[model samples]
Target: MSPRTEQQYEEIREEKKKLIMDTALQLFANEGYHNTSIDQIARTAGISKGLIYNYFTSKEQLLQSLIFSGFDEFAQFFDPNRDGVIEKEELHYLLREMFKLLKEKMSVWKLYFGIMLQPQVMKMVEKEVYQYALPYLKLLVDYFKKEGKENPYLEARFLSAVGDGIGMHYITDPDNFPLEECVEKLIALYQ
Candidate 1:
């Protein structure tokens, strides 16, 4: 066959990059970012360090890429302009979607929560992650306020803390945790 086209090359490159990121996410999440090295990532991913460098200049950039890519998947559900105002059904939909993501994309969220506790990684990624998260947080606060919850911002923060707790529990003990039932109860609590 003739040589692959440019688009095909790019697609292959993206696939390799994703493999590297996924491996690094697991390594960083479990081993800690500072403890992990590019050599470890390359070995885990079954690729050479040079190949990883071709896609990511450094481990910091690789971690940043993983963080954004993980959050980006869930961000689409939080677009406020999509329907102008949030509704109860929309809130339920959002909860279901978030739970689904927590279950289905556990690695991404694991890496996220793991890195959040790391001072070094948090320093590098804090601002961008807050920017990524603010819209969803604001929507939650606004929804609580519209629903007549007292101290809507604090309520929103509590709701977020609950979600984070559930995520941590589910990730830590997924098979034993009643994830779906817990999410249903959480939805009811918010309503």
Candidate 2:
């Protein structure tokens, strides 16, 4: 193939890779990852298992990639801009932004909630997410520390825990949670 033709082929390949990953996530959510097989994923996705391998070497790789890609998407979406550091005032914005994001990502969030309790899945998620989260958490904490908050690290982690709790409550019983209001109330303390 010519260089331009080869480039187009690569683009098409990448799109197929993403399509497989997306279908795999839905199947994994609906059928459970351990129960879902590569052949099933391929059959559901209307592609051959050989084609799936062109994208992901194994089911575990695909699952890990799904989790990692979600984190990557979150990293991008969490930022209001391409700017590296989050301003202190943006902390408030982050709460509503995250809640909105979680609400929008209900399917994936549900998968996340269900899978986290599984030891192997939990380990994989923790390894992938914590590596990504810690630095972002540190950035948030440093922003608070600069603003003269004591124990910024602990406070930052606490906010994450609280947010997770509220998010889970919202997912399970949104009518009862009033999550945005509760989150806003908590954020008031930081101001």
Candidate 3:
């Protein structure tokens, strides 16, 4: 095979990996992460379980991949370079964007919610800050610091709790949940 053929093959492999991730997240969200097995993911993706092993060594690794991919996508949207003096509109946009993504990305976020309660995933999350949601908390803290706000870590933690509340409601009823109204109420809490 030519070099171009090899590159095409690699691209196909990456695409397959992404499909597997999407299927895994969907199943995990709908079925609950604890109930989702590697075999189930493989079946949902229409691939053999053995083929999944070619992409991910284990189910945990697959879950981690979904988490990291989401992190990377949103990091840019939040503007890490901002001075942290977010205006009300920025806050609204943030709230809206978060709710929207969290809705569309329900499976991934659902897996994340469960992962936090799992001992092994929690440890892995702390140890690999670059690869998980810990960076978001850290980013919030640092942003607050740049703005001369007090106790950024505490503020970040508090916001995380608030987010969880809002997220839980949405995840529980994605079909008819009034996320926009909920977000308005959520932002009003800060007012």
Candidate 4:
């Protein structure tokens, strides 16, 4: 076999990193982050404990990576055109896509809500969470302002709270949550 190239090595590294993150997400969501150990994740991923350290400086860093990755995935749906303004159709698209993502990545969202409910875990990541959230909140406020809402910031916050409630309920009872209907109502509300 020909010697592996640099690109091949990078691909292997990325695959291993994803494997570790995926395993960690499962354990953190189902088993609780504090209860899950690095050794446990390494064993689950079929890698050495040391390998995880190579990818992440610490377990907290790994958790942060998982959380940040989910935020990054969400960024794509928020402002696809990179334009400052959010049109009505764009708002609708964002809601539809957000629900689709929640359905598709239940485990990730479960971890998110799980972390938020745990005061300690939430404290650990609060700054980073706010860092990711502020821009999106600003965009929503701007959109609501353009829509002539008297309390655009409040409207933005209300929509965020609603989204969080929907996500929490859907994750808790996905089989009968009426997610599509909720999404339709949310879209209409914003319009």
Candidate 5:
């Protein structure tokens, strides 16, 4: 076989990193983050424990990475145009896409809410979470204001809480959560 090029090596690295993260996310979601050990993740991924360290400095870092990856995925649906404004159509689009993502990546969202419910685990990444969310929060507030909501900030927060509740409930009972109906209602409310 020809010697692997730098690009090939990079691809291998990314694949392995994703494998580790995927394994960790599953274990964390099903087994609970604190109960899962690095050894378990390594065994599950079929990689040596040391290999995980090469990709992530620690298990905590791995958890943070998983959380951040989910955040990044969700961010794409929020402001696709990068125009710093969300039109009514854009708001509906965001709601539809967000629910689609939740359905498609159920395990990832389960892990996210699971982590958020655990105080100790959340503390490890709370600052970063707020940093990541602040801009989006501002955007929501701006959108609500533009929509002529009397209390835009409160409206934004209420919407956020509603999203969180929907995610929590859907993950808890995905088989009968009426997810599509809920998304439709949310879109209507925002409109």
Candidate 6:
């Protein structure tokens, strides 16, 4: 074959990076981050350990990328810039979509929940998460403000805490969790 064009090279690079990311995410989700090593990730990905290093400097960086990637996907789903004011139906749609994503990505959510409970891991990821999360939180605050709720900021915080608590419950007891009903009740109570 003639030398590959720049586009072909980029395509190959992206494919390899995605393979590495998917393999690492599955491993991290199934096994705790501290338990999973670069060698394990590389072996699981069917790549050499050194190749993994070429993509990610360390396992911690790999984990951060996985977390950030999930958030990026979430941002795409929500698309925070597309509206004038948030309506109750719109909020409900958002919550339902979120629940769908959570169920679909249960393993990743489990890995995320586990990491957040560990102080050291939390320290490493807290800033990045807050940065990613701020826009969504602000969206909620804006919704409440538009609804004429007093202390919209505090209400937004309360709603966020409730959502987190509900998520933890769902993550721990997914089979038995009445997610739709719970979400409906939350909407009923808040809206």
lDDT, candidate 6, at 186: 83
Residue-level lDDT tens digits of model 2 in 1-191: 47678779989998899889889888886678889899998998889999988888778888888877877888887753345567657878887888889888765766676677678888767876767777778777777787777888888788878878887787777667787787888788777
Off by over 4 Å in 6: none
Note the Cα lDDT for every prediction shown: 0.86, 0.79, 0.76, 0.90, 0.89, 0.86
Candidates in order, TM-scores: namely 0.89, 0.82, 0.80, 0.90, 0.91, 0.91
Q: Residue 25's C-alpha lDDT in candidate 1?
A: 85
lDDT of 6 by residue, 1-191 (tens): 65999899899889999999998888887787888888898899898999988788878888888888888887888887777468888988888788889889887788788888989988999998898778888898999999898899998899888988888899889889998899888878765
User: How far in Å is the alpha carbon of 67 misplaced in model 6?
Assistant: 1.1
Candidate 1: worst-modelled 10 consecutive residues by lDDT = 76-85
After TM-score superposition, the amount by which residue 4's alpha carbon in candidate 4 deviates from its true location, in angstroms, is 5.4
Best by lDDT: 4
Q: State the local distance difference test value for candidate 3.
A: 0.76
**What tens-digit string does per-residue lDDT give for candidate 5 at 29-49?**
889888999999999999999
**Which pairs of residues have clashing backbones in candidate 6?**
none
CA displacement after TM-score superposition, residue 128 of candidate 3 (Å): 2.8
Give a tens-digit lDDT track for model 3, residues 1-191: 47578779999998999899889878876786669888888878898999988998888788777777766776777755557456545656777798888877777677777766778777766565444456567666765666577887887788878888889878777788888888888878655
TM-score of 6: 0.91
Q: For candidate 4, write residues 1-191 as lDDT tens digits.
A: 65998899999999999999999999998888999999999999999999999899999999989998888877765643377788889888888988899999998999999988889888889998998888888888999899998999999999999999999999999999999999898888865
Off by over 4 Å in 1: 1-5
Candidate 5 ranges with C-alpha deviation above 4 Å: 1-4
Model 4 bad stretches (over 4 Å): 1-5
User: Lowest-lDDT window of 10 residues in candidate 5?
Assistant: 74-83
